[model samples]
Target: MSVLRIDTSIQGPRSASSALADVAEAEWSAVRPTTTFVRRHLGAEPLPADAWAAAITGGPLPEEQRTPAQRDAIALARTLADEMRHADAAILALPLYNWGVSQHAKTWIDLTIAGAEKGERLLEGKPAIVLTTRGGGYGPGTPREGWDHNTAFLRRIVADVWGAELTLIERELTLARVNPAMEALLETAELMRKAAHEAASHAGRAAASSAR
Candidate 1:
């Protein structure tokens, strides 16, 4: 199984959400050492429109864009899509930016899903887990929580657009319980890791039996 680990944190490499995601990914990898892995750090490397347009249009070749700055844009998008599809699982690490996904990640999402031929979501059918670190709580039943947009938007994108099974791991401490939050994160990752592994194992057995 291959796993695509996408970190959309705007804080570059120091993002807390990305940090936790790395841990979860490592755990998953340890369980399945042969799993192939690919990654996209959206915030650190924003998606370009020119390359995106070229790729979507399939005209003039994305590499022919002219100025050297446009370099690698087209190839990156193709590589990103290829990586996503080659993987059997995925991880999205990011924070709730203004109650929604960061602009960087949003761009990647647009280029990835928009106008890709039918039956094309690299994310489709994959077991995808989202790791988040929020500065406040946004759970349902709270008036202010309704203000949150990440869950609603991401849910639609992951389930409807990508046809993927989605899980969420969040650290929302509006009242500041630092240690407990870390512990909770660890616990959640453990559960997610176990579930992913068991599912893969079950699928393997089923496939073996069907081969008879």
Candidate 2:
């Protein structure tokens, strides 16, 4: 089995979402020791800014007619889509940025969709886990309720459009430890973080079992 892990956290090692993804990947590796792992660190090496637009416009054009940049863009999209098509399971680590999806993640999604062949859902029915972290609370009744603008969009693309069997592991109040304004919520933040890790591990185990 193969698992594709896509990391989209600008914070790198300090990123809570990335750490949670590691926990899940560790659990997955525990059960499937020999499973192939493919890592794509988008935060470190984001796709070309113009790749999505080029791909969308050039995909249907004849290769000979496409500009060099367009060709490169199309190729990049195909590579990204191929990773999804070949993976048995996938993990996407995303940190909410300004209550919106990261440009890198969105670019990847757009390119993937543009590259997909007709009637092809590369990740159809595949197990896909999304690890998301937010610096502030956006839960119901919170002052920021309904403030998250990315989760639903992400679901629409990955679950609805790509048809992946989805699971979400979310952690909020992530900035409580560092943000003075959230000092009062530090204890709750710790608890939420711990729970998120546990949930990630559980989901990872479930993914491994399902793979078998």
Candidate 3:
């Protein structure tokens, strides 16, 4: 079985979202020892910022008439879309940045859409595990209630657009231990962390079974 894993965390080794993905991938590999993993680390090797626009504008033009940049963008976009289309399962670690999707993740999403056939479900019938982390709490009654703009969009794209069987794992207050202002919430953050990890394990095993 093939699994596609995309990690979009600039925090590297300290990334909370990637940590969750590690748990999920571990469980998946444990269950499916022969699973092939395709990895894309957007933080380390980001897609070209202008690729999406280039692809969209160049798509209608004849190949011979397209500029080099446009051709390359179109090719890269198709590759991104192909990864999802070919994968049996996917694990996406996309953390909240500035209360919304990070630029890297958005670029990837746009390029994939630009490359796909109109209305194509790239991950149709596949199992997708989305691991997202937030530095602050945005739950009900919290100071930043309703401030989360990331999770909903992820759901729409992964589940609705891609037509995947989605499993979402989220961790909030990830910065409680690092941010002095959030010190009091450290206990709650730990609890959320533990829960998210447990959820990741469950999602991973479930995905492995579904893929098989």
Candidate 4:
């Protein structure tokens, strides 16, 4: 069994969202040391914007006839699709952009969403946790809280396309330095740690049972 960490945090290590993802990963490692870890860093080697557009425009791949770039795109798409489908559990480290997901995040979703043409939901019924990093507070209250597009859009895509069980852990790292705000953020991370471990233990048990 293993966990796939999909780090979509555009800011790399500086991303608060990625920090939470790391905490969650550490919890998993402690609770399930036997589980392998797989990392997909979008910043390092982002998938092409049109990798899976094959279903709509390019049609089936003809490897020999395709350009080098086209071949590269298809290969990444296939690899990503398989990873999403096969992982026992997955996490998406997200960014809050203009009150919604970043363009890169949306592109990843479009390529991986199970659709009429794709036929199978590689993410169907799997569990996924979203770690959101943001500059301002947003989620019903707080100034930019309306920008809390993280929960809603993620829920919709995961439910409709991937069918993955979902959890969201968000922290406003930029707000931490403002007096007690840092404490609040740390508390949120603790809550995320608790939840991530419980979920991991449950998934690990399920996998064991299935194997038996």
The residue pairs that clash in candidate 3, if any, are none
lDDT string for model 2 (1-212, tens) is 99999998899778999999999999999999999989989999998889888888887899999998899999988888898899999999988898899988988888888778876888888889999899999998999999899888888877888888899989999999899999999999999999999999999989888873
What is the C-alpha lDDT profile of model 4 across 1-212, one tens digit per residue? 76778777667666666766776676666666787767878755676666666533433546666766656655566666777766887767876776778877776776655222365666666667777666655656666655566668887776666777666665554545444756757666455545644554454344333321
- Model 4: how far is 87 from its true place, Å? 0.7
TM-score of 3: 0.99
Provide backbone clash counts, one per model.
0, 0, 0, 2
lDDT of 2 at 168: 90
The ten-residue window of minimal lDDT in model 1 covers: 203-212
List the pairs of residues colliding in candidate 1: none
Error of 1 at 46 (Å): 1.8
Give TM-scores for every candidate, taking all chains together and pairing residue i with residue i: 0.68, 0.97, 0.99, 0.73
Superior by lDDT: candidate 1 or candidate 3: 3
Q: After superposition, how far is residue 101 of candidate 4 from its true place, in Å?
A: 1.0
lDDT of 2 at 37: 89
Residue 44's C-alpha lDDT in candidate 3?
A: 81
Tell how far residue 9 is off in model 2, in angstroms: 0.6
lDDT string, candidate 1, 1-212, tens digits: 66777887777665667766766666665567666668778777767746665555553534455444434544566566677666777778766788777777777876666435556766666677777666555667744668777767877877678877677666654223345645555555455445544444443333222221
Ranking by lDDT: 3, 2, 4, 1
Give residue 87's error in model 1 in angstroms. 1.3
Which 10 residues in a row give candidate 4 its minimum summed lDDT?
A: 203-212
Please give the lDDT score at residue 77 for candidate 2.
89
